[model samples]
Every structure is written in structure tokens, then in C-alpha cells.
Target: MTISKRTLIIYLVSLGAFILAVFYFIKTNELRRALKLSEENRDSIIYALNQRSKKMSELDSLLLTGDYNSALKGYKDQLASSDSSSFDLIQQRIELTKKFIQQSRRVVNVDSVNQDTISMDTLAENTRRPTAEEIRNYDSLSFALRKYQIQLDRLKSQLQKKSYGEYLTFSSKKGNSVHYVGQVQNGKANGHGIALLNTGSRYEGEWKDNLRHGEGKFYWPDGEYYIGEYKDDLRSGVGTYYWPNGEKFVGEWQNDQRSGQGTFYNEKGEIVAKGVWKKDELVRVEEK
Candidate 1:
């Protein structure tokens, strides 16, 4: 078979064009795959960062509430679940919490001793009168207690500052101090956040227009705490209130008072009153 020169040249050109087209298509597909993989990796990294921030916030809440054991546990869990190299902050916090726990224990022990000594002195006074030596000893113990209390208070202040240092601080001439950290809109707290007061009180949860308008937890300096709904900066819904002495109230609230169906438990955890309450008083007792 004899072919023309022009015809042979045309066939070769077409074959070359087809091969180049196929190569271009393969490379384009590979490029698309790589881009998709890169996007996936970027999304994952963002998610991980968000999760870490949330965990750190939780730890901060625990610390502010003086829940050392819980804070320690949370830090440990985070460290265990994450790569240690990336969690140096968590490691440092764990150590800080341990020191705080030890200091708190010492304060508690001193307080216990003070209480025992007072009881003994009271009994002796009732029998007769405290001797000169006894009076001097009592004075010494009282002084010691005062010193220890001051130390504890200072430590608490330091802890609060460290935890809230990165937040916005507000101070007033009337000795009111508040530190807030979280979402802000229009120069006001508008979302989830934490607030700590100079009086050793703290609030963590939702905020609307700088008022506690949703669910939240409030902790007092004396170890009392409340967990429940909030409206307009007041306890306006169902909630649980716990006292330092082991008393508890679980029920409804209005304007920060117990104004609805609720149960009040004494220090022994026994229900002292279960009924309708009004203005912090049990108005009607419900038979159990």
C-alpha cells in the first residue's frame, strides 16, 4: 500500500495531539485531588483548635470555682488524650492546681484546729473561767488563724488574677471589681463567658446585654453556689442552691428568692421542708 506524504504527516499530527490531551487530563485530575486533600486537612486543624479552646475554658471555670480536684482531673484527661508536646499550658496548669490544693488543705486544717480550741475554751468557761495561760494560748491561736486566713485570701486573689488576666476588667470606686472574658458585641457581653468578682464570686455561662439571662453557675466566696436558670441578673427560674454547711435548696426562684415549689434540705441532707415557698419562706408544706 502506497500512501501520500501529506496524508502520513496529517495522521502523525493527530496522534500527537491526542497523546498530549490525555496527559493534560491526568495531571488536572491529580491536581484536583491534592487540593481536596489540603482542604480536608485545614478543616481538621481548625476543629482541633476549637476543641482545645473549649477544654481550656472548662478548666478555667473549674479553677475559678475552687474545684481543684475536678480541675486537676480535667487537665489530666486532656493531657492523656492529646499529644504532650502541644499541651504545655495544660501541664503548667496541672502543677499550679496541685499547689493550690495543698494550700487549701492547710487552711482547712488550721480552721479545724481553731474550731476545736474554741469549743474547748467555751466548755471551760461554762465550768468556771479560762486561766491566764489558757487566755494567752487562745490569743495565740486566734492570731495564727488570722495569719493563715490572710495567706489563703492572697492566694485566691492571685489565682483569680492569673485565670482572668487576659479578660476585660472593670473596677468601680465603690470597691466593685469584675473581670469578664468571652464574646462581646457592642461593647457588652452578649454570649457565653465567665465573670469573676473581687468578692470571690464568679459566674460562668450565657450572658445577654451584660446580664445573666440564661443558664449559668454562680459560686460564692464562702463556698455556697447556685446552678440553674437566670433572667435579668436574677435567679428567676428553677435552680439548685448549695450552702457551704451542706444545706441545699432545689426548686423555683423569683427575683432571687425561693418563690415557688421547692425542697430545702438541712445539713444532714434530710428534707427539712418540701412545699410551696414564698419570699424565701416555706408557706405550705407538702406531705411526703
Candidate 2:
């Protein structure tokens, strides 16, 4: 079969077009697969965020009802199961949810319950409790408690507003006198406010019923800042503390002090020392 030049050219052109078509088809399929995978990941991220938010809501309700055990379980599960490297939005959602759950947990007072019950019963059955002045005093106390409760409710509402993600709260006390402020919700400095030390230092952050809870930032007049988790007005969990002497410590802190593994950095933000600190002192240090 002797092919003419014109026929040869036509065949070559057809073969080239056929190859281009096949290549285009494969490329389009690959692009479609990639897009599908991306969409799936996006949906997964959304689902995870939604689940975490819902858990947080449930946690709030549990906390309001004083169901700490269940709430704590949920909180721990959320923290453990969260994908920390997800998008910023997802990470924030998870962080805030965990914060709410952990913060709302009321400090259990094992001794106060029995003491309060006994005191209340004794007060109620006082044989000489018929004085008008005494009754008035009791009434005044009741009124004050109600007022406090109302204020607490309003503060919780403010926290809910802040938790929606658009506000920060801070408190300050001036002078040599010490004044306690309180813990806040949704990162607003709210709840039972207490000044820890009178030495011109302040810690402000998440608060629940006037106790420090969740992530808190504490600042001292001596040019120190501690940023990390807190429980019951104390630094507990991972945190970074900046000292006045141009040094910093970053590590897992507990009970308003450095406890566990940490790194002490020099003024240049270089890790000059690494060690386990207990009670704010280096128990062990490894120079690297």
C-alpha cells in the first residue's frame, strides 16, 4: 500500500488530535477527582465544627444544671478528638468549645455542703428568732443574694455574646490596695471577681461564678505576663510566663506556679535553659 504525501499528512494529523483528546480527557478526570476530594474535606471540617459547637451547648446546659461529671467527659472528649491542624475557623471553634466546658465546671466544695446545711437548720430553729430586727436583716440578706444572682445571669449573657467571637475583656485595679475582680465567660472578665495578690498584679480572663476558669492572661506591674489555661484562679495547664527580667518560661503550669516540663528562654527568645520547674523554681535544667 503506497501512501501519498497528502494521505500521510492527514493520518498524522488525526493521530495527533486523537492523542490530545485522550490527554484532555484524563486531565479533566483528574481535576474532577481533586475537586471532589476537596469538597469532601470541606464538608468534613464543617461537620466537625458543628459537632463541637453542639457539644459546647450541651455542656453549658449540663453546667447550668450542675452536671459536672458528664460535662467534663464531653469536654475531655472534644479536646482529645479535635483536629488541631484544621483550618483556623475550625480550630477556634474547638478551642472556644473546650474553654467553655472547662470553665463552667464549678469547683466542688465537699465540706461546704454539710456546713451550710447545718448552719441553715440551726438558724431556722433559733428559739429567740422572733425579733423584728433579725427578720429584717434576714430579708436584706435574701435581697442581696437575689441581686447577686441577677447580676450573674446578666454576666452570663454577656459571655454568650462574646463567645460568638467578637470581643475581649480586661479588668484593672490601681494602687497598693488589692481588689479581686472575677472570672468571665466567652473570654470576658466576668463572674466572681477576686484580686489574687495586692502587689499590683492582676489576672483576667475566663470567669465562672467569680473564679478563674479556662484560658486566662495575667499581667503584673513588674512587667510580667502569663498566658495559658487556668482553674479556680490559678494557672493550670499549658502556659507561657514572661518575667520582668527579660526572661520567659513556657511549659505546662499548675496551680499558679510552674509545675512540670518547661523551657526558660532568654531575652532573645532563645531557649537558654530547659527543665522541669516546681513551685516557680527550676527543679531540673538541661542546657542546650
User: What TM-score would every model get versus the actual structure?
Assistant: 0.48, 0.34
Over 1-288, each residue of candidate 2 has an lDDT whose tens digit, in order, gives 899999999777766665544444444444444444444444554454455556656764563344656665765665565443223323343444344334433223001111111112221221221345544544554455455445544544443333223223233222243333233455544653324344545454576544567877776665677889988667899999888677988898887788999998898888887888888888997776
Highest lDDT, which number? Answer: 1
After aligning candidate 2 to the native by TM-score, how far in Å is the CA of 110 from where it should be? 48
Best by TM-score: 1
Cα lDDT of all candidates, in order? Answer: 0.67, 0.54
Give the residue spans of candidate 2 off by over 4 A: 1-199
Alpha-carbon RMSD of each model: 32.4, 33.3
Q: Write the per-residue lDDT of candidate 1 for residues 1-288, one digit (tens) a residue.
A: 999999989767665554444434443444444444444444554455556666767787787677889999988988787554335546666766675575456334112221111111221111222345544544554555456556544554443333322345565234577666655667777777767666656677888877788999987766788999998888999999999888999999999999999998999989888999999998999985
With a 3 Å backbone cut-off (N, CA, C), the pairs that clash in candidate 1 are none
Q: Which stretches of candidate 1 lie over 4 Å from their true place?
A: 1-166, 171-175
